[model samples]
Target chain A: MAHLLEVKNLRTYFHTEAGLVKAVDGVSFHLDEREIIGVVGESGCGKSVSQLSMLQLIPTPPGEIVSGEVLFEEANLLDYRQNSPQLRAIRGGKIGFIFQEPMTSLNPVLTVTRQITEVLELHLKMEKHAAQSRALELLKLVGIPDAARRMNDYPHQFSGGMRQRVMIAMALSCNPKVLIADEPTTAVDVTIQAQLLEVMKEMVERFRSSLVIVTHNLGLVARYVQRIYVMYAGRVVESGTVKEIFGDRRHPYTIGLLKSVPRLDQTKSERLVPIEGLPPNQMNMPPNCAFLPRCPYRIARCEREAWPILRPAGGKHFVACHVDVDVKERARETARS
Target chain B: MQYYYWLGGICRGNLGRSLVYKEDVSALIGKRLPVTVHLGLVSLFISVSLGITAGIVSAVTRGSFLDQLITLLANVGVAIPTFWLGIMGIYFFGLKLGWLPIWGYTSPFQNFWLSTRQLVMPAVCLAVVPLAMMTRQSRSSMLEVIRQDYIRTARSKGLKERAVIMRHALKNALILIITLIGLQVASLFSGSVLVETVFNIPGVGRLLVNAVFSKDFVVVQACVLVVAALVAVVNLATDIAYGWLDPRMRQG
Candidate 1:
């Protein structure tokens, strides 16, 4: 079957005053219908950029989709202009987006009903009365309390988590096929992160839509996302099923990421191991592997050759690396010593 | 004693007679009120509509040639004095081009074409600074509002670029723009004083100026009183607008 969405060799660049910034350099991924996946990367890794570029949401002039094909259900999304009616229809009609900073994601001046009903009216051609009822239904579905009374309140009236629920309600109002949640809980309290994710995951499954959770935090998505695409320096360094990535992570950067985050399963005595060094600056990315400086297991080939493309390490597992760092085995060997 | 008497007369709706005009202060101001108000309203409408349009255009096309030209003009507009601009308008439109009259106020109801032509210089002079101010304020406010997450959310919701700007961004931008308008009304009122004299128009501002020189204290007091009252009403309207544009500001 054809992939629900496929991004192949997608390149998005920013023409900054300093120089050209390869914000999303040659990223490729696919999602199946009703499948849930995660794109993992630290800040500035272009995970969010890649997701936003699919909808052409980034500001142009400074930002541009340099070259690439974004195929949504076999249609090339990149063919349409950013302001074209077709593109506009596809944005919230077929594909919904949940951004970070839920506090600010909703318009402060607009009421909950206006924001949610607007999408329904625009996409579904629902009348004012129908849209209002549907918007109320959505708010209740997203677990917003006192739905009727709160419908007229601005974003400021709601707490952070409540606002996020409103955002989720709005995103899911049109029942989009592919829901992209970009660090959806990053700006909220840590206690509410998992709860929000649960509501989101529950809604996605209930709606029978595909999900792509883009985040810098591994722990936040580890329990929810099925497949993982590990990104670094605007490139997908590794990708695999959750089992393959956690049990048999190969890329040095991915291993570093796993160690850096504090896992709930980990013993309290174990010290968190942070990844050394930052990702290369986009303006001055090296021709060779971008992670060579940060990769603890970097080989001479990593420095000499251009970044390696994804090659199969196992079933549905791929890693772009000059060295095969079977992190699990290496840890086992180190423990024996 | 004189001040007490004048204040008491004001309470009774009696502004003492104008010594210079040899008429009742109320009658003199009453006749000229329409002219002043007519000029004020015309100049205000011009400033607000044109200013907001220019600002929105400038913001959306910040790096374009049009944006640059608007910014440049706005900068120069705010810097130019109303009296000087009025003099220049008279010299050019009145003297050189012979397109518009230099002085005097004519109601649009009298002769729309001639009244518009007459209003051109005085209104333009009065509107210049506020227009520039509105342009700058709205541009900056729009730039900030568009960068906001909600605007991006609105865009992502498949809204037409126009709807996204108009429905989402403008309401928020208007909050700040509306606040600036309150201050502008006061400045515009004060501005007409210079502009009216420069153009030799018969309005309350010119009346006040003439009263000051002629030592017609009651007319001067009445002008200040009328202007203060007008400013209060406009500010009240602005506050109501603020609540309407941003419901968050509204009291339950």
Candidate 2:
């Protein structure tokens, strides 16, 4: 099947005062039609940067796409002149983005209707009356009550969840083919987060758009995404079907992540297994495997040489570590017990 | 409070007569008011238009050669004493160049071109302070507004760069610019004294300066009260404009 989006050997680097920080170092992934892909990593692991690079949203001068191709519908987006008017037509019209902070994402002073109608007017060339009606429709579709009255209200008037719904409404107003949601639920409460996730899932399914959900919450994306890409130190350490990742995790980092989450099934006496040591600084990343220093199952070969390439273990399950997959599992189970 | 009430009554045209001029203070103001208004309004128009345009350009192309040059010029304009700048203008544009009349105002009914020519030098000189002040204020305000998240949102919406700056950024910066307009009015009324004296323009500034020197208490008092009233009114207008510029102010 032809992929809807494909990123090949993506490398986004930031030239900082200390050194060149490899924000998204040599990452690659693909999505098919109606596929929901989850990119999971801790903060600063380049999950956000990788998605930003796809949209060419990284601020240039300090940050740049060093070398890569972000292929959307068989076309390399990275090669397009970002400032060109033609490229902008594709941004909101073909692809939509949902930022982490809903408050900061929506323009504060503008009415929700104006914000939504901007996309309709710009890309669809809809008239004011038509665009406004469409905007109200989108607001209703996102489950905002009294959508007509609320259209003229500012972002601050909405609750956190409502504002997030407004964001979702704005994102889906153009019926984009791809929606890139970066930490959409991190700011809201758990209930609101769940509601937002449900709304997003419903919207994605209804629109039949491929969704790329980037978040550090392993549990949040487990049910939402079909394929999961686990990243560490700006690299995709492991990527496979959600079942392969959660059911039979291979990468030591992936296993460590699973052990770290406090499961609801756990007893009151159970202690969460937090990953030891901080993530490696991208500027000072080790020459060999980045996770080797933090890995409990680190071998002599892990320190002496570069880590093994991402290879399929079975049925499209890919892992990066050279250590035996069974050994990593045993270590996780022992730590949990 | 009684004195303020008295002042308010005088402002409402209750004041009787000017001791020095031996004329009704209300009548004196009515006659002289139009001259001052013409000078103030024209100079304000020139200053605000030129200053805001220059400021926007300077801010949008920050750190560019034009920005640096405009900043340098504004600094010099602010530092130069208005009196000295007026005298220098008179020397070059009036006496030396012989392009304009050295002093006086002509009735526009008599000769419209010549009357405008006589008014030009002093008006230009009186405008300098406001121009300098407005340029600095507008540049700083535009800089702050440009950094706002709405500006980025506007850009991301696929609006052209000019639309982002003008509609998004500049509109938000207007409250500060309007506040500066009030300040400029106060400074311009005071600063015009030197220019009016040098040019012999029949305006309130010249009247107030001559009255002070002559110790014409009634005329001086009348002038002071009028200026104070002007400042108060301008400030009130500016306060009202705050609501128009920012909706948050209206809520408060």
Candidate 3:
């Protein structure tokens, strides 16, 4: 399948009074057509920053995309400066973004229909009547019950989940080729998270659009995303198919994340093991491995040299670590024995 | 029923008699109310339209030279007293420039053009302080609304920058702007006092000031009641507007 989007060496930095903070440092990835991918990281891990950098959506005054190339539809999006007509055309019309916090993400003063139709009118040039009907159809598509009647309702009139559904409708309204959902279910309850994810998966399939889910919850995306990118300290520490990641996890960070999550299949009362220490500060990062302090499998070379670059471990699986995977596995077996 | 009887004269539409004018207090207030309303409405219109426009411009172009200029002007406007500004207005437009009448009131009904000419200086003089206030209030309110997640949502929708601002940011900011306007209504009435006195307009403010000086307790009391009642009505209207603009406010 042809690649819908390719992000190469994206580095987004914030110039603050203290110093330059490398929010997204040397990140690179690509989304195949109609593929669903998950980017897992703790809060402030630069997941959102990397995604925002793709559309050039990061605020520019203090925040700048110092260097990066985002090729969408064979065009470098980063080349188009902020608010340029070309960038604006692609931002919502071709590449839609679903932000977190449905409560504050939908305009408080506008009716749902008007908010949805504004996108249609701007990009599609649909008339008021046509846009209204399309917006109603979109609401229905997102499973908003009685969508036609709710068209005239303001955002404040809808419940939190329903408002998020409305946000989904607006995003998919334009049939974007790539939909980036930045922690789409973070603000909702557990029950609603499953339902929303289901709706989202269904919507992306229906629209034939690629999905990029940015979230820290490993469990939530395990079943939905086909490929996974585990981020640590603004870098992709591991990348592989779901089966390879969960079954043959190579990176220590990925293993720690999997262990931290409580499993339903485990009937025994076992305590979840959380990763120790805090994420490295973006401003004063050391030349050595960022996760070295917390990594149980850290080798002497990890502290002496720069963090290892991503290298192929096995069939389409990659890991960034100085320790050999086979050696680490043997050590694990010996320790268990 | 007991409270009604305690204020029986007021209940019966008798506001007592004016001491100096030797007329019914209600009748005297009735004649003066129109003058105050006319001046108040015109000044309010000028101040609100210009103030809101200035505020929106300042907010949208924040960090620009124009925003700094407008903000500095607003700060200076709030600091300068209206009475002092009125005196300066008369000295400049009325004396130095010889552009308008210095001191007089003309009934628009008798001659519309002359009335408009007579009103320009006083109305602007009356509007300055509130205009400055509205600009500051709306600027801050608009700044807050612009930071909301929804405004970012609006931009992400690929809507034109203008539509994003006027439709998304401005509408949300209007709630606070409306409240500011409501508060200004009362301030305008009081502000008209000095302006009316300076321009020699026979509005309620002037009547109240004259009655105060002459110890005409009935006339003074009537003017105060009228101003108080107008302020109450303005406040009620403002609340209704809030409910209309944001339905969440409607439930309560």
> Candidate 2 local accuracy as lDDT?
0.84
Predictions in order: lDDT: 0.91, 0.84, 0.89
User: What does candidate 1's lDDT look like per residue over A4-120, in tens digits?
Assistant: 999999999999999999989999999999999999998999999999999999999789998899999668999999889999988899999998988778998989899999999
User: Which CAPRI tier for candidate 3?
Assistant: medium
For all the predictions, what are the DockQ values? 0.80, 0.36, 0.69
Alpha-carbon RMSD, each predicted model: 2.5, 3.3, 2.1
Fnat values, one per model, are 0.87, 0.17, 0.70
B75-158: candidate 1 lDDT, tens digit per residue: 999999899888888888889989888888777888988888888889988999999999999999999999999999999999
Q: Residue-wise lDDT of candidate 3 within A301-334, one digit each (tens)?
A: 8879998889998887999988875577768879
| Candidate 2: residue A184 lDDT (0-100) | 92
What interface RMSD do all candidates show, one decimal each? 0.9, 2.2, 1.0
> Could you tell me which 10 consecutive residues in candidate 1 chain B have the lowest summed lDDT?
B243-252
> What does the lDDT read for residue A81 in candidate 3?
72
How many angstroms is residue B59 displaced in model 2 relative to the true structure, after the best TM-score fit?
3.6
Off by over 4 Å in 2: A16-19, A279-295, A300-303, A306-309, A322-326, B1-12, B15-19, B98-120
* Per-residue error (Å), model 2, residue A330: 0.9
lDDT of 2 by residue, A175-208 (tens): 8899889899999998898899889999989998
